[model samples]
Target: MGQPVMVKPTFEKLIPTIGSSFRCFDRTGLNLPSRWHRHPEIELTYVDRGTGTRLVGDNIDSYRDHDLVLIGSDLPHTWQSDQYLGRKYDRHSAIVIQFHPDFLGEQFFELPEFEAISMMLTSARRGLWFPAEVGEQIGAVMTRMTIEPPVLRLIHLLEVLSELSSCPSAEPLSSQGFAPSLTSASETRTEKVCHYISQHFRNPNLSHEELASHACMNPSAFSRFFKQSTGKTLTEYLNELRIGLACRLLMDSDMSILDVSLEAGFANVSYFNRRFRESRGMTPREYRRRYTEATETSNT
Candidate 1:
């Protein structure tokens, strides 16, 4: 019954246009709190600026300016921007497109010539990462889509997907177990559990019993089921979740070590320090100093 993570959307009030059930947005001047949320539509995102880590399903990777990614339906993801990269209003721009599988119609994909695209879509279940060059090329098309006519937009999308399917350097970003699915009772419970943990990572009072209750399951059953689903022990996963939050805080906020310890959910400063060192192979202060120095050097 480790705490659950809640996935919140950055933009909620702005809905897309009619006839275009799919939506696209350019996110700037904002940052996301880490959580896992999903929808039934596939997502394509291109980051024009900023640097941080991206978590798609169970895969975690460092992302720099100009990262392009495609996430399949129901794949959980978050784009975490570091503090240094968040200094300017327009410095973190991203192009995000969301569309259903049948948006182009079922018959479009069934055509013999679309076999590669079909395969690519199937493979997209695990998420996809494009090389910088490919990203740049695909990103150009996405940018064009903002101004193109309906018919031309479809053509551009087809070209982009074709290129993606043929690109040799593209890699899968999510773990092998990262299966795509519509939200169900079990999935909702899992999502709730993940969200709670993410939000309360710094709260020492949080426990498995409390989490199990949130999911409406017995403590023993919840513990066993969570482990089976995530491939990690309840405590271990919670610690990792805490550490992940701590890492983000360390890089994004000026909060001191003691404050970070409490904010990330360790009961005591000493235990937080010990676990931080054990999990990251360096002291909290040391990790921050090194990471900051490295970022500064890169910028300079």
Candidate 2:
């Protein structure tokens, strides 16, 4: 699991209360805002084509074509398109289904037939992902469910849900410990701070004063506000951003450890090694070697 980040998600209702039944959307290569957000409805999504980062309540990972995910209500999520932040023609189109937990009324869970689905929904509180084989088996039915005639569509949906409830290849994405809430003014401000850091962490000029200026607060006040909101000092957060980048480099590239350290904004190799060990419990070299070996084995 990726390190859990409990930031507030942008709050909004996914579907307008028009029809009594749930809604399905078949969008083809349309650009959607990747800003983090949440709603009260549970969501099931299948990406037929795309490549990008998907942030689902701390389960940060890259997503490619055929990615299928089911997120419980109020869990924050957004998929950033690798094509371009706003470009629609390159990649990313999906079949999405969204509904309130009580779309069939609260009494639906009382049925004996729905017992397994009830447990599955409960497990989705942490977010669930069906495997590729499950996706292949069910993806077509899901896409068609959105546009099929009402009565038949509902039956297909039930069938899909039953399949999901028992699919052995399923797994949870985000950690159970990640319980985020609605967005607030304070949270919005911190999000801006985080955005600023993510964009400029490599700059040597990045400091508490620089960050405070972006936040429109004086140095001392911003320090306290940031610590309170994120539970980490600005310095620690900066290091986290740098370390995360370093980890990505270690996994994907052939850069030397010293070069990776400098590229990740550390002044020297020794300090980077110390911090890497403290955060990762191993030196950068070992991390790269182990990760590479594991990846090679998996691919073979």
Candidate 3:
């Protein structure tokens, strides 16, 4: 095979023009894809409306209106909006702010006055989700930022960060152990490998040899590279993907355990059961029941 075609993750280059410290996009009403992309800039996003799955690093969860999040530089992420999944009327909308770590100046955030905000940005490497109330408050300021002059908008961005630093409810999204090695030297190769896995992890017959060939590396070398790049063995990575899919199916579908196992690419239901228990600390049925109870309780 003449180098199997690779679908690499999109690298967004959002360089600002002359005299601009950062970029703000007020996407008032828009529908976008679940396109997995990354940039070197830290990002703050506020969802004004819509609901869907938000994926940051290896973390995947649902998001609704007034959702707000901060993503660190080079973290692969995407908001798979309801509209992107064919819920056409559920138009997604958000305000996105992007800036380099040293956008103001190389040592600006290192100053004593910026200590709290600086620490918050460091924690954001794993991504952070703010409560809806915080989202609403920050969203208003971000909305105004769209119309404000460049100088004033820069100041507003600092205010936003200052407020976020003190938010006690800010939750880290991605697992602390989940690290993506997307350095410039290996980014394209890593992105190709990751994107391919994302697209093909559902194949029960998916083999290491196949993946190695796709990445044009020998099996042993590929195994080491994969571990170093993603911090997981190939099997471990695939199981995480499969289990995540199974969880979603359990929550959103009425599929039987056997069917869920088969659909999620496990060769047998017995193995699936064992792996599910290992990963979740409970049987899939128990997980589903707990999730159902929680959902119903919230609804009530």
Compared to the true structure, candidate 3 yields what TM-score?
0.77
lDDT by residue (tens digit), candidate 3, 1-300: 233355544688988756677889866443433456789899999998876567787776667779999999888787755432224534456899999998778999999999999999999999999999999999999989988899999999999999999999999988888777767646677667765766566789989999898888999999998877666788987887787778777876789999988887899999999999999999999999999999999999
Report the backbone clash tally of model 1. 11
Model 1 weakest 10-residue run by lDDT: 5-14
Model 1 error, position 115 (Å): 5.4
Worst lDDT 10-window in candidate 2:
1-10
Model 2, span 23-140: residue lDDT tens? 7778665343355666789888888765655657666555656788888987767665543223343445688888888988898966999998888888887788887667766778
How does residue 165 of candidate 2 score in lDDT? Answer: 92
Quick one: best lDDT, which candidate? 3
Model 1 Cα lDDT, one tens digit per residue, 81-153? 5543236323478888777788878687879999998888888888899987788878877887867666676
**Model 1 TM-score (2 dp):** 0.68
**Candidate 3 least-lDDT 10 residues:** 82-91
- What TM-score goes with each of the models? 0.68, 0.69, 0.77
